[model samples]
Each structure stands twice: as structure tokens, then as C-alpha cells.
Target: MNNPEEKEITFVMPFGPQHPASGHFNAMITCAGENVVDLKAYPGYLHRGFEKLMEYRTHVQNTMLSDRVCILDPFSNEMAYVHAAEISSGVEAPERAKYIRAIMAELGRILSHLTWIGIMSSALGLESGAKIAWGDREKIIRLNEVITGGRLYPCYFMPGGVRDDITGDMAGEISRVLDTLEDKGKLYDDFVFFNTTFTTRTNGIGVINAEDAVALGATGPTLRATGMGSDVRKDEPYDAYPCVDLEIVTMEKGDAYSRSMVRRGEIAASISLIRQLLQKMPAGDFKVKWPMTKKVPPGETYFCCEAARGELCFHMVSDGTDKPYRVKIRGPSFSLALAVFPYLSRGVQIADIPAIYWSLDPCPADMDR
Candidate 1:
């Protein structure tokens, strides 16, 4: 207790690992007079030190760990790493294999986005929105199981191409899932976007201008939300992306609401892209023959893919050994984590923390890996 004439001083509060709405990371926020003054992000609570571990394992073994980086979008990491390896070894996957890879990647994108929607809605206290998003997400996961015999970490990608071919029934099942998701997407829009509470909480909050977005290395929906028509799939054009037509989606405002809308719009685009890939998919060998054990040439290669989160890139250095000398992953979440502190600190309320974090879609595993 203090005297009536005495003044009170505010201090910092840490919100984190166990916090209901903090997502998978921890944050320390300092406040003065009901306003956050400084915020710092502390990841690595879930870090697995994957890059260091990869050095001790063979190239094939490393793929298993790569999936752990971005648990939600494992396929993207697998594809990027495997593609880098292929480039280093001067090996090209069969044309059919490339198409199959594209299909898998797109399916993974849908699943990842659905998961993000569910998580975001849950953070915002929108129970119905979370349920609908997750209900749709499970279908995509089932599709993944059908394709790769596993739901979360399928390990379906390989150096030469994919691990296996997609069955005719599986391809049809994917189409059906897309249709179901399309119908549910409209419901999501009506229930989540049209809700007054959601609109007020998200709209015009944590806004990032277009020029600042570029300077800060923001990518994916975050950058797209700022009206930048940039997408790695279109500009870099890796794997089956070059073979398929794509439309990059963008929004005028870089606010939380705009980011959500951008993701919503891209989900539809991904469904269409998957449909096109399946419809035009040609029949051929799904795997190219390679030595059971081979050494990567002494060289370095870099490759990137437009993952659900953003542009996921990988740089590999091979020292003419079966195991890579070094492998570095450039995950998109790093940028999100770095940018979040400044935006979330002072001017925002505790309730807005989750909303802002979800808008950025921080995947701590990716950031700390």
C-alpha cells in the first residue's frame, strides 16, 4: 500500500508460451499508463536446431527434419530443400513427377491456410469461425493422408521427384474436397467478415504502408495486403508453377483485416490452381532413377517456393559428400517475428495482441529452427 500522495509506476508484463492467445511463442511487453511501451519476442521455446542437426545426417535423412521447421507447411520446406538438392546434383525430376509435386504442394497450401484461419478465429474468440475453418481443414488433412499415407508429416517429396504417384481415386477425392471447401468458404465470409465484433477488432489495426512493407522484407499475404502484386510463384516460377497459369491477389490496406481478406482470397485461388493442375495432369513415370547412395557435386544452390506463409527459400552447400556441408533455411516467419514487436507494443491493448499476432501468422517453429 502507498500513500494517497504517492504515484504509481508501471512495469513490464510477459505474455507467453502458456498464454491462451499468444500462439506458440512468448512475448515480453512493457507498459506505461495502459499503453505498451516496448515489446520483445522470445522464440526458441520450440526450436529443434534443425540446421545443425542436418549437417550430421545424410541428404535423405535431412528431409525428415525439414518438415519440422514449418509443421503447418511441411511440403513447402520439403519441396524447397529437395529442389535445391536436385539442382546441386544436376538432376531433373520427370515431367509427371513435377506435376505431382505441384498438386501436393497446392494441397498442403490449402491445409495450411485452413489451419491458419482456424487458429486466427480461435484467437479472436470466434468459436463458430474456428469450428468451420477446422472442419474444412480436416478434409484437406484427410486428402493428404490419402495421397501420402500420413496427415501431418507426409514426407512425400524426394530428391528425384515425389515419393509416389497419386491414384485416380485420390485425384478425384482432392477435387471433391476442393468443392466442399469452396462452399464452406462462403459461409466463412458471412460468419467471420460480416460479424460486427470481428470488423471492429481487426479493421484498420496494425497497418503497414506499402513502402514500409517492402523495406521490412514482408512477403506473402502481408506484402500482398499492401497492394504489392509480388508472388514468388509468378516471379520465380519453380516446378509446376511455370506450367500453370496463376493470378496474384493483393489488397489496398496492410491492416489485419486486409491480411485476413488476402488469405481468404488466396484460398480460392489455390483451389482453382489445384483444379487446373489435376485437370491438365499428364500420365507418366512419377520417379526418376538415381543411385541408392550418391554424392552431391561440390557446389552451392539456392531455391525458393511460394509457401502458404510466404516465400520459403533454402541455400545448400555440398562439399562433394553424401551429406551437405551446410544448409540454411530462410523461413518467412522470421520476418513476421521481427516486425511484430514494434507493431504490437505500445499503442495496442492486450486483446489486440492475439489479433495482431495472428494477422502476421507467426510460426515460431519456423522462426527458431
Candidate 2:
């Protein structure tokens, strides 16, 4: 029974505060019936006062703190903080240590990306893709745990270099894992990357132009997917990045598929970097002994590194105290999450919002940090 005098009303629908696809983030999306008209990102709850907490910890103690800021890509946070600390203290890591650090960071990238692939696929309803990605993720995690003491947040990185050294047959073990990863790459290429359903859902979806992406301060793969070749590794080399050769990966589509492809290409590229590192690694001390209680020189430094998600930077100010003066974390997801509104403008359907949101790959921990 329809009433002639009745009216249909359109209102804003909340997308999260508890979305299983991504983590803890919310979106208030206004829709005109089934078509999306506006989106407001409400990201937080993961802050935990990470920066303020870092100030109270000692120089070495904060490395563990940095890992919690962005759990998915712990090495990048470790690298950035270590770099800043080294610069402030006038210490340089040994060549062998640098190579090991780079190798580990690349491995961390692969691990994070695999997890991301599974999440993204699941968000798009591609169960097979998610299953394959998640299954392969275990192989990398096993290799990581064997090297670093911890399975997830390794805490293997120290101020001068790494906490420990890779000696004897460990390099060989790493190579064997790399070989296995290459074989699995073929499996993913066939089943996931080239799948028609994936292409249909991703290609041309959630498009971001190069100009807009730059203006919005998008970094890492988000900017690169728009055909920007900007990379912290290639642009400004730090750690072992100067020693190893890297080819920046980019895609012009500026869509979900392009971002996913950039990460996939980097996974392959990271494997090559790892092999190069093992071959070129010099024999030397793993770390320069620095007591955890030592205070850094009175100075400020900004260190940025390309993580699996994007450019992660840490701005640290040390007033010659064992405890830091002030620390600010610049996460890649902040700007990307804000830009969600522009991409969600009227043309997109209400059902497609999650797909588009997942495309930006915002990490609530990163954003809130």
C-alpha cells in the first residue's frame, strides 16, 4: 500500500567505527537514495598518544615504540627513527649493517603487501584472491621470525645498525625463501592479478588524477599510481638504498588496480634488492655499541622513508637529553583518507563506497598517529 502524500527522505549513513575490511576508521557518507553525494572521514582511536609517549622513552627504547605506531610496516618506522637518531648522534652504520637493514626492510614490505592484498581482495568480494594472498603471507612471516627474534614486530633495528647480524647459512636460507617467493609470484599473477573480476572491479575505479594527488600530498604508491615517480629511496637515498639499484614502479591509471599493481611490482623488485644485498653484503660488525641511556645531541632532524603504504616520516627534536624533547609522526594515510571525499563524489554508487575507500588503503593507526 503506497501513500500518495508520503515522501522519501535521504540521509547520511555511517560506514564504520568498526569495519572488518579495514581497521578502526569511520566514514559518514551522505547518499541521495543509492548514489553517494558526500563522504567525511572520521579516523582516530589508534593514536594512543604515540608521539607524546615517545618523549618519555630513551633513545633506544623508542624504537620499540615506533613499531606500535604502524604495526603493519614496522621496519619503515624503525628505519626512519634510527636514521634520525643516527643523524643527531653523528654515527654511521657499517656497510654490512646497512645492507642487512635494507634487506630486512624490503622483506618487511613484502609481508605487509601480502596482507594488504588479502584485505583488498576480501573487500571486493574476491575470496579466492584473498585466500591465496593470506596463504602466501605465512611463508614470508616464517622467514621473518627465523631472522628476527619476534614474529611480528621484530625490534631488530638499533640506532647504529641492526640489533644482530646475519651470518653463516642464514643468507642461504633467505635466498631459498626468495626462490620460493618467485615461484609463488607466478601463481598470483595467474590467479589474482590477471583475474577478470579483479580487473573489472579495480580498473578505472576510484580514479585520482596526478595533479589532485600531488596537491593532496599523497605519497608512496598512492602518488606513484598516478604516474608520479617520486620515491624517498630513489630520490633521497638513505641506509643501503644508495648502494642498491632500484627501478621505480608506476601506473598511469590512478585507480585501485594501478595502486595494487604498483605494490605487486615492488614485491618483485624487493626480491631482487634482497638478492643484490646478500651478494654485495660486506663482512663487518653488525652494530656500533651505544648504550640505551645515552642522550642524543641537541638537534632536530627529519627522516622519511617509503613504506609499504606510503611515505612515513619522523620529525625529532632532541635537546641533548636521554629522553626526546618532541617527536611528530607523519603518516601517509592522513592525506589519503581526507581525499576520500573528492573521489566519492556523486557518480559512485553506495555499494561501491567500500571498494573505493579500500583503494586508498588508509591505515587508521597511521592516520591517527
Give the alpha-carbon lDDT of every model: 0.84, 0.84
- lDDT string, candidate 2, 173-274, tens digits: 889988988888878877778888778888888888889888878888888999999999998888788888898999998988998899889899999999
Cα lDDT tens digits, model 1, 261-311, are: 888888889889999899888888888875646699999998989888888
Off by over 4 Å in 2: 1-8, 340-346
Error of 1 at 217 (Å): 1.9
Q: Where in model 1 is the C-alpha error above 4 Å?
A: 1-9
Show the lowest summed lDDT stretch of 10 residues, model 1.
337-346
Give me the overall lDDT of model 1.
0.84
